[model samples]
Target: RYWPRFPRPKTVLTVKEVPTVDAAFVLQSVAGLAAKAALRGGNRDMVWYPIGHPAYLRWHEEMLRQTRANEQVLPDVWAVVEHFRRAGIVKGYVLFRKDAGDRRLHQRGAYDPSANVATVLAARLGAVMVSEDIEHEARARGLQRLADARGLTEEQCYEHWAAQCSDSVLALVDPRVPHCRAEAIALDAFVLATHGPLLERALARIRPDSPILGWGAGDEFQLTEPVSRWALWQSATNWCLNLPVLSTEQVGSTFPASSIRARQRSLWDLTWEDGVHYTSFLMTDGDNVQWLMGDFQFGAQRSWWNSPVRGKFPMGWGACLADLAQLCPYALRNLIRTASPRDDRVLMGGGYYYPDLFGKSRNSLEPLRLHARRIRGYLRLTGTSLLHMNAAKWDSPEAIRAYTVFAEEIPELQAILMVQYAPYTAGKGRVLWVRRRDGTELPVISARFAIWAHSPFPDDGPPAEIAAKLNAEPRLAEPATSDAENRSQPAEVPGFSWVTVHCWSWFKNAPDDAAAGAEETDQATAAASGAKRGLEPVAWCVRRLDPHVRVVTPTELALLMNLRLRPEQTLRRAVAELHLRLRTAQPARRSAARGFLDKAREALVKRNYRQAFLAGKNAARVLGVMP
Candidate 1:
């Protein structure tokens, strides 16, 4: 009935259709969409959602009341009713006796159990009763199951027990023809499912054994294996091998280990030789790339041999392509190139009702709009830079994955994700690679590696620590005879205070500042006409955070360039690079003062109205010309 105007909206985009029966739910659904869209700046120019807000609830309720009574309802009223049914606004449903001749519906004047007057005239009223037909459908299917399970007893069983309790159970019969699982679950109505995906999700929410009456899987499924558990990698995959087709065990690659190992070792040699050169060589490995490309698009997996005539796994198909793209590199694009619809696999096998997780296709490789969180155990680990290998075979893809899982699955290294990836091979089968993927590089795996250290403000001289008087343990409450909580001392170390350092807090080099100062100097030179103001911009060092800003104090500026931890600036990891850079250059202040004074001296000597301007700035100080 409505739409969100957004994303430049070159073409109208839609989220299928809204549940039309439940009007209450429609509001929540719309609000939910708006809340998420509000977080991003992308749709600012477009309308987020529609009009007709729920703030005016009374008008809607009256409209619903008028709709039930009216023989001919307006489209707006009908639409609202349908939205309510879909969104699940009705709190209760028809729960009538099933013994009646017709169970399809209640009489038009059926008693409203909810009315204050129903019980008041209970004995006097002879109103008809009706129930939503969800359980009734289940009884029909359950009879079918009983027939298959016991044989020769299906019809008789229904004839005896089902009829004897037909009124008791028929009222609970399955499938409300007017509505379905969406309405049932949304309304939290207890109803039976006939072996479907809705049943899976519903059973997951309301405990699987919550007296959930459903037709047993008579024809839908059967398995010889009873229970499953992972023998390795997972405790369940081992038993899952009992699946009709392939399982994780069957999902592994058959690429020869020796060949893969040789390729990896060759890459390792390249890293040892020259990183840039190796990169250049791999880019030209046309033969190796072409072989991988053909295999990528043409494998036994492409044919229906090992492949499924019908497939499953919501993330598997896209995962396969993403994996191939990563493992074989550019071959993914080539694999798609020279490929046809006939080359793809057909998808099938249950979970079709799960429109979101499985999408609306049996065998579609639609782009998955998914956000997969790679907890360290799950990420592909590559020792890119500063990565120290711990007794594991370096550059072995399998070994890296194993170690990453071990680090994450094991107790001690929990919450940590170790990544491994196939490194780029370069220059005649050699590898030049970063030792370990640094924190900056960790983003490739969509992760952040935060390190913790125990230090007592080495640069701050412990003055700040004494002033705060904090400790790891929370402060103890003073005794009744002692001071009150107000005067109680805080812990010696406060809670875990995490400080992130980006780089070395060094001043910008004088040359860089001079380059920046070029324009201003040009302007000043222009103002001076043709005279040599000798106003050359001096070189000075500054840290990234406004590093070129003038520094007035020696002590404040000294700690910045020493590579030593600065009192205020947070920079530790890159201190090594910063130290090398700063130790090689003069102090920023010294160079700055010299340049300013030199220009002033030249101006004053030339009588360029600068003798007064030379008040305190000395050119000697700037140029390092003492005395």
Candidate 2:
């Protein structure tokens, strides 16, 4: 059963401008309007005319013309009608027109299932359908003959009849009418069914060039999948791209999938939502945890490591540390070293785009100050007091500037230390410098034993091959030059004949644990040969290569570079620092701390740099600072 009730506006307000209609906005407006309308008249009836109806086409054209003429009328009239229908305030009916050509066309429905579902929901909410009267249709035909006599074609005459019929019925609608709860539910259903395609279309149209403009995405122009035929057209002419932005034409491949990066992205979102309370956990692939300690991943890792934590004991605050196999002692040391700052705050991990540091001009110092404040906030939340600022990517000038700013802004903060990307490659574990915008320069000292994060020794050939490679390269010696010359001139990284034997991370067809163990054995053998020839190890091997091979913590290495100390002197200095920290320590721990310091001094006297470093490192751990 169907009924109709029309409430004509007392005065029709003319629309001055016509803007492009957005379905999402229309849905929201309908929600707001329905709530109001339902409150105004509890049992009021309204009519919902489908946008696909021939009546709507006429109204659309007229609306456009009127808007251009500056004559006011209801804009998005179809949206208003649909909302009223779904709101259960309207009677749903097809108005009859005598001259309307091909009556079957009017009965044809919307192609989208979601659109059909919407109508069903509206009908259930108290809408009724009705057809036109036959007697009234006969009178309409008499007027159609006049339209035909006025030089109108058959189709034009029929359209005019249909348009007039729709106008007579719809003109009764008040633009401000709203709906009820039933209508709101119907809109939600429609949105759920249609959101997928809408979101994808929105993502596709986004301009990848500028991130600022990307924030304002989600334009309403739309088309869906399962097309009978498709083509890209310009002015009714088809065109094809010789080169596509993506190599694959598959749409599925273009959309991002779940991965480590996706996890990191979600964590970032969580951080923004409630950074104070949320603790994020990241499970990443690749065994390059050592590389993670390097400069490459610093910016990304900062968001996690520096995120604010909550609770009285720092239990619920900050992120958790995890890895595939058991984490290495050196890796843990590095993690602690990287996380530590003077007041025990979080690290900024440098700015968003660190490489552009030198090129971009900063008018104010607020950005740097903000990052520093974030660091301080993290420290305060975590209940910790100090973080060791070691393991840095010293290559970027901007990163150096950020570090310099941190030192300047924070009162209790000490100067930031930096390490080389790969010490074995070039720059010879020397101290580097960066020039600030004000022409002031800052020192960035390198860590000793520029240990290979991944295996540096090659396995393709014999163990002697490692020595042959290092022997071919220039020796690792400090450059005897002025600070100005060092800053102005770029040093070329000496070429080594050795091959990159072990890639730390996993691959699709990577070897299993057993095979990996054997590979490590071969790499260690090669490393030992290189050590015999004065080639230093950047990182620790799974097994010790030689008793005399020196190993030092990143901080100790940096200290050595700054002081220009030889291996024995560096070891002795580390031993002295440990003793100094334990001088005023409690009696309970004094004995244990003093024992390690004494052992370190004895090893230094024995001229065994490797043993001395280990003893010194242990003493530093006992005293609670690696410096």
Candidate 3:
């Protein structure tokens, strides 16, 4: 609901003085999500309202001019509306003011609750309009002071009959109003949100040429210390790709404290004075979990808003809404019934989009398998994810024995080791590792091997219910991670010179039987000895591999993913391929293996695969292609 007081703009085309927005990009974003959502097979229906055009206004004026005029328009309008209504869809419209309150939330300004106008617009338009009454407050106090900045006022003066209110057949809203579209899009259904901040922001990062609907990302946005302005772009995406908003009642408990991001610590309600808490920022939505991430299902995986950054920052509009639309319903359902839907945290739900997703490869330090689309990252199996375990386990006799053996043998056996005794939960787990034909371990990792958690929290993810029943299976864990669990990396990773990840205190814990043992139980005795055992600067061997087969850089991976690179991508992969061959000979004869690989790249250019593959094969004695 826009404050009726703001003045109007002549046209988006004419508003060149202000920054001319990417109109095509914006509309493309909305359409991208809508097309995929509509095509998704669901019992749901979708409703779309095309505004900002003279045709719509002419139609509106014709209907409003005469009581009977509405009857004529009703037939065509009802045809479209009835199609959705028959399919059980309840939808609404959002109009662009060309002039909206840009005064950031939490500014001192005029009372902008155009509740009457919202209700009236709903009555006239036959839908419920989202009232911008809430935007007056944000992050802190003395808010709305910049009211005139973005053109917000007490009343939305741009529209006719500005003060009427009604609850009609549709829902009217403005994206600027924080939870306006939240309520609308949160409903479990198919929808097309257009002409609002929701659409604008979602499409902000998209290229106008080609865009896919509902894609995915890990929770990098949430875990990072400081929030990036582009991070808000996630809010736009979550609304566009996720299922309906969750009601507080469904959670039965408060939002988990795991939800509150350190970057959001200073965020508060926007009330200018007491007793005027018109808009609420219940930051600790049940347990302090961030707001949009509360059981929200937005993309192919958890929202990237909650994961760690990789080589290069990922793109927003590049999200595959179409891929998400095609995922199993359980992918969305997992957020509620299964363990933590930690798909990058900010967004939740979504199964593997492809049928042949191989598996994960953790760097052996932590066991959580953080994934984004086809690429998987670290597990939240560190101390913070456990909410227990101090900084002393690495040097314990038990820790030394387990890890040294793990490093040498686990990779040897193609197993991703998961400790069973973290303070967060109970049970031990064992999931074998997956290695590519190239002998590199996959990054999807699991910690189901550890067994000392005292409660039902998933030490390993929910058991492979569907998979084992159908095929001998393996599934990785996705835990709600904490900033505390974030460990520091040693100066070097053991095997790979360029690879490194932070090792945390929670890596290993006492066995259940040992917890009560006299020797291990003596904390005072062990802390001192634990330090001498060589755990002070916890050792780490890590690798931040590009999830793609050959790409070493995230920029290249993002491009491959955007291009829909699939399993076959490996066939055309452009990495340095090495070739070597050797044959045993009689004692007197000498034998040797020769090798060749792609020449080093120059400047900023990536390696050329076609040239490199041929180069490597030339060195092989048996030149016949294996495939």
Candidate 4:
């Protein structure tokens, strides 16, 4: 036997001292750096060690063959065998009976059961199977392969795992590791940033079973989420106290009740004023397109609280909150038609006028991002995407600047700057520059004209008149010009030339007589104009406008603006360059357009102007423009 000399006398050394072992090899095989660090940190559950890759089938076959034949093995091969034997990797799999449980176990390897078992046991033992350098790429590949095989997308896989497994589950990325312990690390960061510990704890202390204080029409109201029926069955229930139980006829005759008692106190005591606040909470359920066109009606009040003679609905967040509860599901589903991590397309957009006035500042980037995230989650769950325009509350230059910064920071969201009212527009919506006190101007992202009409209220003129005015009068403002841009411009610009009008009266509660009056108006308009029954006045009027006057949504408006506006003749220059490239292209490069060019040349030579124009038009169309 080979023996190594020790520092002390050999006679004094035991038989164990005769064999030489490298300290580095022993430290690596027995107690790795990651393992030693874990031990030092007192976290025994984290027992991961970077050992080796899954060995090829041939490597194991040769090793087993050598062992069975009683042939000598290399030192490195002997070390691997000795390490696995000592670690009980082979024994652990046999004890667990993994192969017997899963038919797909053999897919990973064609080697003997023990060889495959070693790799499986190492994985089960929390070993780091691959180097950290390729971890991200490896996770991506794993997700892709699973998605390809199962016919699911990578996002779907992540969502499924998040719902069924853990919110922090990285299973789509790291199948070999099973589940990661650091899954909720990103969520924790978000929670800390948004809802701090103090607020979280304060909200947590409120008993869920306590009676919820809510105000709205009871029987007439339609909750947005369908699970409201289940919510009533739970202990933390919401009771809408003001049900307009009286019929429209009885609403007038009944005396106003004095006060109500609930949870050991009069409801009047909680109020600052002796008179109760009148709030409007309307819910419209139907096709959102019809709703957008002002076809939907507000729910019947049939109660004294919202009696048109005694009180008017408050126009603020209290009213908006009620409406939001009803329209949330619809807005979340229909408003945002598409979403993407990188898509800059403007599919749709709309502005909320009162979000910041009530407190939740949509003018800031964080709130917008948070709102986007909420919609993003909903869209991803349903496998959809969309774009929206969230406007600031105030219509001042300061508000515009704040919102512009928000939009600039998050261009992917494609936010369009807006304000509730501006002196220049006087609340009649207009996309004009507001000059600040400091003489700086801010560009508002709405159309130059807006028609705000409340139905049954009569502030906005009849739909026919408004529609005719819009078609005949509204036009996009002339493009901003610099000295260098002296080229000719179109005399009449075409497309959506005004902000989408607000027909809020379409959501007003009305008396039976008033409802009949509206019906009469509808019938009269239909008879005179031959418009379709049940169409909103606005929709009817728009249909009557000149066919060339387009009715575009806010998102479509943004797309058109970006498309038509040339920043210092950027679009013009690009088009010119494309034409130049076409004209000067080599024969082989222009071969695709050679036939059109030849036809146009022949027609010009023959003095056939019409034929020449036709061929030229075709060639221009092919070049992505018209002559």
lDDT of each: 0.20, 0.28, 0.22, 0.26
On the 0 to 100 scale, the lDDT of residue 541 in model 1 is: 13
lDDT of 1: 0.20
What shift in Å separates residue 371 of candidate 4 from its native position after superposition?
Answer: 4.3
| Stretches of model 3 off by over 4 angstroms after superposition | 1-45, 48-79, 86-369, 372-374, 377-627
TM-score for predicted model 2 compared with the true structure: 0.27
Sort by lDDT, top down from the best: 2, 4, 3, 1
Give the alpha carbon lDDT tens digit for every residue of 1-627 in model 2. Answer: 000111212222222222322222222233323332432444232222223323233333432332232222445434344546554554332221222233222122222222222222332333211112222432332211111112222223223332222111000001111112122222221111112333332223222110100001111112111000011100100010000000111111211211111101000011011101111011111122323322112332222232222111111111111220111112222344344221122221221112113222333345445545544443333222222222224445555565566545443321233332233223332444444334333344332222222345232222232222222333224232333321222223221111221222211211222333232233345433322111111111212223222222222222333223245543554466567777788886678888877887787778766566666666666665633
Candidate 3, residues 1-627, lDDT tens digits: the string is 000111111111111111122232122222222222343433222222233333223322322332121112222222433343344332343222322455443232222334322323332332323223322221121211211212332224223332231111112222233222322222211122222333333222322211111211223222110111111111222223212211111111222323221111000101012111010000001111122222222212222222222212211111112122222112222322322221111111111111011111111222112112111110111001101011112224433333333233323221121222232112111112234444443221112211111223332111111111111111111221223221222111111110111111122222223322111123244333541111111110011112211211212222222112121222123222222222332222212113232231221134343333343334232332221
What is the model-wide C-alpha lDDT for candidate 2? 0.28
Residue 534 lDDT in model 4? 22
Give the alpha carbon lDDT tens digit for every residue of 17-43 in model 1. Answer: 333323222222222222223223322
Task: Identify the runs in model 2 with alpha carbons over 4 angstroms from their true place.
Answer: 1-352, 355-362, 376-400, 410-429, 433-443, 446-548, 562-627
Global fold similarity of model 4 (TM-score): 0.31
Stretches off by above 4 angstroms in model 1 are: 1-404, 408-470, 473-627
Provide the clashing-pair count of each candidate structure.
74, 24, 98, 6
TM-score for all models, in order of appearance: 0.17, 0.27, 0.23, 0.31
RMSD of each: 28.2, 23.4, 23.7, 28.3
